[model samples]
Target: MASTTPQGLCIHPRQMDFELPDPLPRHWHGGDAFKSHLFDAMSLQFPDGERFFIDSVRYFREHIGDPQLRKQIRSFIGQEGHHSREHQVYSKRLRDLGYDIDRLEGHVQARIRFTQKRLSPQRQLAATAALEHITAIMAEGLLRDARHLEGAHPTMVRLWRWHALEETEHKAVAFDVYNQVCGNRSLLRRAMLMGTFFFVLDTSRGLVHMLKRDGLLWNWRVWRGGLSWLWGKRGIYRPLLGPYRDFFRDDFHPWQRDSLELLQRLRGEFDGAHQAEEANGPVPS
Candidate 1:
């Protein structure tokens, strides 16, 4: 369902089998429980979270007037739809390993339910726009930083690389939709501020839950490594703070942060030959 756009962007989905065929190691990231669990904890949030993203965008899909963005909506939906399904299978891997993935997913799902029920349509779209910004930046970090996936299982690495690539491809769709339909700047900014807070809180809660379950809650090694991985010399989170704050700028848009070569490289590395050959313009090799 993925195709090239007029601008030469590959706007389609790459459907891959993210299967955990073996008994997965509890700590898959370079054998560090904290590092592995950090990403796995984040995985717990994706299935339902991505669904909410799809729904928020879908809610506004029919109303979009631009043909290019309208087409982009379909591609965005396709990409996210694949991400949700793949991550569902991916989450089950952690669930099978006794990480209590379902419990956290339930809490997150309930939170999404509350947002859907209580927030205005514009507010919901604004939230989606804000959260998409978070994911896009996070994806950028993962793609740009080799250490994020280094020492991880091959399957996991490929899966995440694929996700990062597609997230880059479609990062602007929801924001564009929000911009077209909603003109209230404060709603967008306010939602972004709250979204960042909750995103970190929820991710931490899930990671801590897994740590306690794995009986590594007090492990100083994991504590040290996890802190270092996120905040150390080559830490992923520190570099993102500036980009994260960029969301508050009034003229900000996803394209303002360019990483086109990153997109090309990841797609070339992970995409099947067929998918790659079909990419038009600047999106494919």
Candidate 2:
């Protein structure tokens, strides 16, 4: 039997560590606009998503009557709510820059309604877990590729970095929940659901929107850059994709291919910076 203790799901919310740059990058000008658009879309998507999941919890609690699972569901909802709020603030910054976020928001609402109508709670959770897994992998990949983004806008880079880090931190929660709730479900079915959600809904939507907004969708330069980044010498895609693909296997765990060593290294660097500040005494206000 799986453990239902709160300790099993304990997750620490780390403070945002990355610094946003002052001036934005040139290549990222339109991208930032798109991000603003995307963030608004996420704001719309997340609340509805959260409500659906919360309702799922309520449904399960009534049927299964597991108090521990109920608490876990609440924590998951809280984390997602925080994500929605943060992204909403970030989206407002984009709006302040004069982007039209309303249309983007409308599109998101439509998508959410479509998803709600089409999927069961189990499949919805499966999709969410898959997306979370992808996000986690992308987070680690971005950190590894931060140097490549050096010439990009600082604020955009910082936003992506912070988003990536948080994604990595909470990657396991949804999957764990999905596994716990969907008892006796085959891993193969879960894997197929995840792949379909990402490839069809998430990735395809992102690519189409990006292309329409930036005119870079079919551009060889953008394609080359993306491919190079994903498959290049220092590419993180290989390691990142491994665990996700293996998720269909009977032995899969959320942490199976985790970049734990890298995570630890980054944590050490963060701690060391704090120690250095302490050693130098408090700075003048």
Candidate 3:
């Protein structure tokens, strides 16, 4: 665990410079119909979500008085903005494909209202930290499990891969921000909020949206496959939970361990593959 002092919290700005590769898969153009519907529902509540993050940074800047932390928050906001833009494009393609983006977004907005009216700021921040942690873990898992995705839809894999890379880059930002804002808060409270919010709201919404789009909500195969993916050796949830526990431990620093090494290896593999393809010249179509 790294110390939480201002001096110990610095993150390089260059870490956020990576870009998505060109010629992305076509299937990803229309979105993962299932996930898009779910995301549409989720995005409805935070209509100006990119602005919400920017506002949060403003709040932190006025109250926190930490320049480094503020810079990190801004970088996180920028990364999130990029994500929002890309996802919006993907969702639009889904709408063009005949999915009900408006209806789904409306339902998600209603859910966000319920959560905002019910939860306190402390609880909300805790939930944000937990969700960010999960995202970071899943990002790593996707990079690790690239093989499972290789022969599937290239568009889906490319979208997820680009997402995973960004997630890894900003993994520490939200948690660091939450800790700075809520000094000396109990870890138990954070853990409780994470479990409650994720299982009750996030997972429920995702499952419902997945079912609505795929018509596999009642299908055993979908259930089995989803559960297996979630709980299996390469699953995101299991490995992520361990880090969640570490997050509560006394000495945790985002930079303490070299978790980004896996990311480096994945990048190397991608670069090598491109080079090999170039060496092979044009293949017969």
Candidate 4:
């Protein structure tokens, strides 16, 4: 199954307590409601989504025999746990802003419950692996490009960059585990198709809800500008298309795209900050 992930890959959790601004700016992404909510919608899903990823991978943890992969599984759980906690705070910020965070999260929670109850463990892990690929590609796109967060609020930008960085680090953990346990390419392919559909659906639902709450649901200009930014010539998401399709290839491995250099490059920005947060102690704001 395309050989396991790179031999020396180290996956560890980076503890970061991002101080999200009080009463987060209504349109933190360049004062653009569409841009901000698009990300917000996705963030809203992370708390529940990440937990499901943890459970799905943890289900197969005991079945894995490789010592290195087993260690990665632990770190994967740790990283995702931290992500879920941090995004819960982000969700609370949205709640404080009157966005009906509970209602949105309820939908994701319900879906995960049903999946866990009805789907096979193999299917569950396949779904997790597929979703990881989805996040991994987007994470790489965000780190490699600037326009995605151009004009975004500094704190929000840092929060996302941190999440993206970790996502890149452990992106293949679930896939590697799935290969070891269930090596079913057909199942993984189907999971990707279904996972992508629901991801888009749920994110869109959250986006529309936020925009509706802000009274911009029907605004044509908002739609035009946001759609252009996503799919237009030189769009931020346009570059992800090729990488997204690579998951279906017979010999595909997450490391084949070779983002090790990019990961090392981005680590410089975060690792130092985390080290300082440790050395100097977190100053009381």
Candidate with the greatest TM-score versus the true structure = 4
Question: After superposing candidate 3, which stretches have Cα over 4 Å from the reference?
Answer: 1-54, 111-123, 191-200, 233-236, 265-285
Candidate 3 whole-model C-alpha lDDT, 0 to 1: 0.52
Candidate 1 overall lDDT versus native: 0.82
Query: Please, what's the RMSD in Å of model 4?
Result: 4.0
Residue-wise C-alpha lDDT for candidate 1, range 3-76, written one tens digit per residue: 12226566767667767645778888878888888888777788898889888988987788887787778888
lDDT of 2 by residue, 1-285 (tens): 353223343333333433323232313534433333232333334444445444444444444445545454555555455555555655455345444545555565666577668877776666666666665666787677754345555666565555555556556656666666784347435645655464446434544464555555567766666556556776546566675576566656567665655654554433455532231122211
Q: Which candidate's lDDT is highest?
A: 4
**Compared with the true structure, what per-residue lDDT tens digits does model 3 show for residues 7-108?**
433222222222333333323324333333333344332333433444344455555566666566665666666666666665555556554666655554
- TM-scores for the candidates: 0.92, 0.65, 0.67, 0.94
Tens-place lDDT per residue, model 4, 1-285, is: 556567777565778999899889989999999999999999998999999999999988889998778888888888889899999999999999999999999999999999999999999999999999999999999999988899999999999998998899888999999999989899999999999999999999999999999999999999999999999998899999999999999889888888878877777777865552332222211
Q: Which of the two candidates, 1 or 3, achieves a greater TM-score against the reference? A: 1
What's model 4's TM-score? 0.94
Residue range with the least summed lDDT across 10 consecutive positions in model 3: 276-285
lDDT ranking from best to worst?
4, 1, 3, 2
Poorest 10 consecutive residues by lDDT, candidate 2:
276-285
Stronger candidate by TM-score (3 vs 4): 4
Per-candidate Cα lDDT values, in order, are 0.82, 0.52, 0.52, 0.89
Error of 2 at 201 (Å): 4.7
- Models ranked on TM-score: 4, 1, 3, 2
